[model samples]
Target: MNDTNSLEPVTAAAVYRAYNGGYFKTLVSPEQTGGSFALLEMVLPQGAEPPAHLHEKEDETFYVLDGTVSFRIGSKTYIAGPGETIFAPRLIAHEFRITSSQLHFITLLTPGSFWDYFMEFSTAADAVPVVKAPTELPPADFLMHLINRLNSQYGVKLV
Candidate 1:
C-alpha cells in the first residue's frame, strides 16, 4: 500500500494525449493511492467520445470542470455542464462525448487499476492536435484485441 498523505501537484508535462485530440492528466494514480482509486483530468475537443464500455470492478465518477458534455449511462442520458458531476457504477455500460467546443472533466475510478487503460492506449503522436470521427478511427478488431487484453489485466470490459 502507498501513502496518501502527501500532496500531489498537477504538472503540465505530465499530460497524456489520447489518439483523438483529448488530453489526460493523472492526478492520483493507483500506486499513489494504495490501489484505492485513481483520479484523472481530461480535456476533450468537440466530437470527442469514447466507445461505450464498462468496468467490471471499478466504479467511476466524473466531475465536469469546463464546457458541456453528453453522457450515456446505461439507458439514461445526461447533459452536464461545468461544475456538475456524474457517477457510473461498476458493471454499467457508459460513454461520454464533448458537446461543446472543448470539455474538461475529472474522472475518478475506484480500485485504481483502470488508470492503466488510459496510459496503455495513449501515444506521443496523440499530442498533435487531431480529432477524427468514429468512422475514421482505427480498426475495431485491433482495438478490441487490446481492450480484451486490458480487461484480462485490469478488469475493464469494452462492451
Candidate 2:
C-alpha cells in the first residue's frame, strides 16, 4: 500500500471564505483524518488581517507562496515575501496583513484540530462584517472571541 494514499487532498476552491477578514481554503483538514496536521491556502487582500493573537499550544508555520505580507511573529515585525517562511512557536503572539493587494500563502497548523475550530467559530458565530472590500479592522471583542476559543479549546493563547 502506498503511504500517500492514506492522505486526502483539500482543494483550495472548496473551503469557505473568511468572514469580514480575507479568503482561505483548507488544503487539508481533520475531516480527512490526515494526521495531526492541517494546511490552508490563503489570499489576503490589502488591509486585511486576523488581529494580534497567539497560539500557545499549537505551532504554526507560514510559507509565502506569492506577493508580500507584513507579518508579526512575536515581538518582531517584518515583511515576508515569496519563498519566505515564518515559524511561530507555541505561546507566541502573532498576526499578519497583506500589505499588497495580492498576497497569497500556505499555512500549516500542527494538530489539525485548529482547522475544525476555525470552521466552527468562523461560520457559527463571528462578529466581523464580511465586507467585500478592504476596510477597517474588526473590533477587539471580535478577535477576542476567536483568540479565546483557540486558546481554550486548542490550548492556543493570544497574548
Candidate 3:
C-alpha cells in the first residue's frame, strides 16, 4: 500500500495531514485500480469542514467509522453516525462537518482521478501524525487564493 500503491492483500496507506489537523489517506488509488476509483480514509476533528462544493467528474460515497457528521448533499440535509453512509454525486453541491467530537470515515470516489486533488497536499508518510494542529484556516487572503487555484483546475466549484 505504501510503496506499491496496492491493496490486494492490505497494507498501511501514505498519509496527508492538512495544516488544520484533518487527515486523508488513500487506501486504494486510481492508478492502482486502473482508473476505476479511489478509496480514502479521513480523520477530521470538529469544525474542520470545507464550504459547500461539487465535483464535475466524480461522485463520492462516504461510510462513517466513528463519531458523527452533519451533511448537506444537494437538496437533502441529514446527519450520519457510525455505520451510516452518504452519497454525493457529481455536480451536486455537498459539504459535511464533523458534528461530534471528531469523525473518522471512508469515502469512495468513483470513475477517475479526483484523488489527484488530495495528492497535491499529501506527503508519503514516514509516520502518521497524532498531535492536533491549529483548526483555523490559513489567513483568509491566502486561503481564498489557494482555494481558487485548486477549484479551477479540479473542476470543482465552491457553492
lDDT of model number 3 = 0.79
Q: Which number leads on TM-score? A: 3
Per-candidate local distance difference test: 0.79, 0.71, 0.79
Writing each residue's lDDT as its tens digit, candidate 2 over 73-100 gives 8789978999999887767888887777
Among residues 3 or more apart in sequence or in different chains, the pairs in candidate 2 whose N, CA or C atoms overlap within 3 Å are: 20-130, 36-112, 56-91, 56-157, 151-156
- Determine which window of 10 residues in candidate 3 has minimal summed lDDT: 10-19
lDDT of 1 by residue, 1-159 (tens): 336886676344456555456667688889998999999887777765767888888999999999898889999999999899999999899998787888878999898988877787776442434544344556899877777776798776778
Per-residue alpha-carbon lDDT of candidate 3 for residues 1-159, written as tens digits (9 for 90 to 100): 346665464233434544246677778889999999999888877776778999888998999999999899988898999999999999999998777777889989897587887777555544664535355566898787758766887788889
> Which of 1 and 2 is the better model by lDDT?
1
* Poorest stretch of ten by lDDT in candidate 2: 122-131
* Stronger candidate by TM-score (1 vs 2): 1
Pairs with backbone N, CA or C atoms under 3 Å apart (clashes), candidate 1:
none
All candidates' TM-scores?
A: 0.77, 0.70, 0.82
lDDT over C-alpha atoms for residue 107 of model 3: 89
Instruction: State the weakest 10-residue window (summed lDDT) of model 1.
Output: 125-134
